[model samples]
Target: MASTTPQGLCIHPRQMDFELPDPLPRHWHGGDAFKSHLFDAMSLQFPDGERFFIDSVRYFREHIGDPQLRKQIRSFIGQEGHHSREHQVYSKRLRDLGYDIDRLEGHVQARIRFTQKRLSPQRQLAATAALEHITAIMAEGLLRDARHLEGAHPTMVRLWRWHALEETEHKAVAFDVYNQVCGNRSLLRRAMLMGTFFFVLDTSRGLVHMLKRDGLLWNWRVWRGGLSWLWGKRGIYRPLLGPYRDFFRDDFHPWQRDSLELLQRLRGEFDGAHQAEEANGPVPS
Candidate 1:
């Protein structure tokens, strides 16, 4: 199954307590409601989504025999746990802003419950692996490009960059585990198709809800500008298309795209900050 992930890959959790601004700016992404909510919608899903990823991978943890992969599984759980906690705070910020965070999260929670109850463990892990690929590609796109967060609020930008960085680090953990346990390419392919559909659906639902709450649901200009930014010539998401399709290839491995250099490059920005947060102690704001 395309050989396991790179031999020396180290996956560890980076503890970061991002101080999200009080009463987060209504349109933190360049004062653009569409841009901000698009990300917000996705963030809203992370708390529940990440937990499901943890459970799905943890289900197969005991079945894995490789010592290195087993260690990665632990770190994967740790990283995702931290992500879920941090995004819960982000969700609370949205709640404080009157966005009906509970209602949105309820939908994701319900879906995960049903999946866990009805789907096979193999299917569950396949779904997790597929979703990881989805996040991994987007994470790489965000780190490699600037326009995605151009004009975004500094704190929000840092929060996302941190999440993206970790996502890149452990992106293949679930896939590697799935290969070891269930090596079913057909199942993984189907999971990707279904996972992508629901991801888009749920994110869109959250986006529309936020925009509706802000009274911009029907605004044509908002739609035009946001759609252009996503799919237009030189769009931020346009570059992800090729990488997204690579998951279906017979010999595909997450490391084949070779983002090790990019990961090392981005680590410089975060690792130092985390080290300082440790050395100097977190100053009381």
Candidate 2:
């Protein structure tokens, strides 16, 4: 665990410079119909979500008085903005494909209202930290499990891969921000909020949206496959939970361990593959 002092919290700005590769898969153009519907529902509540993050940074800047932390928050906001833009494009393609983006977004907005009216700021921040942690873990898992995705839809894999890379880059930002804002808060409270919010709201919404789009909500195969993916050796949830526990431990620093090494290896593999393809010249179509 790294110390939480201002001096110990610095993150390089260059870490956020990576870009998505060109010629992305076509299937990803229309979105993962299932996930898009779910995301549409989720995005409805935070209509100006990119602005919400920017506002949060403003709040932190006025109250926190930490320049480094503020810079990190801004970088996180920028990364999130990029994500929002890309996802919006993907969702639009889904709408063009005949999915009900408006209806789904409306339902998600209603859910966000319920959560905002019910939860306190402390609880909300805790939930944000937990969700960010999960995202970071899943990002790593996707990079690790690239093989499972290789022969599937290239568009889906490319979208997820680009997402995973960004997630890894900003993994520490939200948690660091939450800790700075809520000094000396109990870890138990954070853990409780994470479990409650994720299982009750996030997972429920995702499952419902997945079912609505795929018509596999009642299908055993979908259930089995989803559960297996979630709980299996390469699953995101299991490995992520361990880090969640570490997050509560006394000495945790985002930079303490070299978790980004896996990311480096994945990048190397991608670069090598491109080079090999170039060496092979044009293949017969």
Candidate 3:
């Protein structure tokens, strides 16, 4: 099992720029529009969504008694801020592809703003913890299966692998903050229930729009490609069912499912890849 101790985690905020050239296909992941749009829709929310995560945790910084957790929170904020900036560029690239990405992102921001105005800080913090769990599990799903990202744009794969690894690294920061400040299991569970609904609803709505725009909404082959990606043993989400249900456990913690070995393996893989790139001639700016 992964250590639940905060001291074992290293939260680093990396600033990265992925050059997804114009030559890349609209269906960047596995060359399937459905799969690509599914991720694209999720990317649309990351910039503002990450800002909310940062704000929610920082709001209760005064309540934290542990110095280690306080440091982790700072790292978490820095990491999420950089993630937001990177994904903003990613979502904008979809706009350059003629999709209505900005409009969907605006809608997502509107909902977040509405929640901020109408909800209690405690509830907002609970919502952040809940969503963090969701992302952690989704990240786990991706990291577990190397083949899950097979045939994706190389830069997109690197970007997502980095995101997933960091998500694993700092999965517990917000939840730790919420627990230290305002953890009501019943209230957190309720927020998770509703949050799950809206998360799916919003992503699906934007995905449908993107699919329609790509003229893939009615394409049977496109949907088959999506089904193949989302169903069966190879599916990224099928394993998430167990982890997602674990969120409702009485003493739930993101570190309960130990995938530290997987993290270690990927870290080595990515490190060696980066070293090889460095050894090569200078990459084009």
Best by TM-score: 1
lDDT of each: 0.89, 0.52, 0.80
- Alpha-carbon deviation at 132 in model 1, angstroms: 0.4
Q: Tens-digit lDDT track for model 3 on 1-285?
A: 222753455565555677765554788887778888888888888999999988888899888888778778877887788788888888778888888877888888898999899999999999999999898888888888876688888899888888887788678888888887777889999989988998898799888998999887999988887877787557768888988999898878887777767766666544555542231122211
Cα error, residue 108 of model 3, in Å, equals 0.7
**Runs off by more than 4 Å, candidate 2:** 1-54, 111-123, 191-200, 233-236, 265-285
| Deviation of model 2 at 243, angstroms | 1.8
lDDT of 2 by residue, 207-277 (tens): 46546565666777655655665577765457667765665666665545455566555554334554322
- The whole-model C-alpha lDDT of candidate 1 against the native structure comes to 0.89
Which candidate achieves the best lDDT against the true structure?
Answer: 1
Q: How does each model score on TM-score?
A: 0.94, 0.67, 0.90
- Stretches of candidate 1 off by over 4 Å are 273-285
Decide which is better by lDDT, 1 or 2. 1
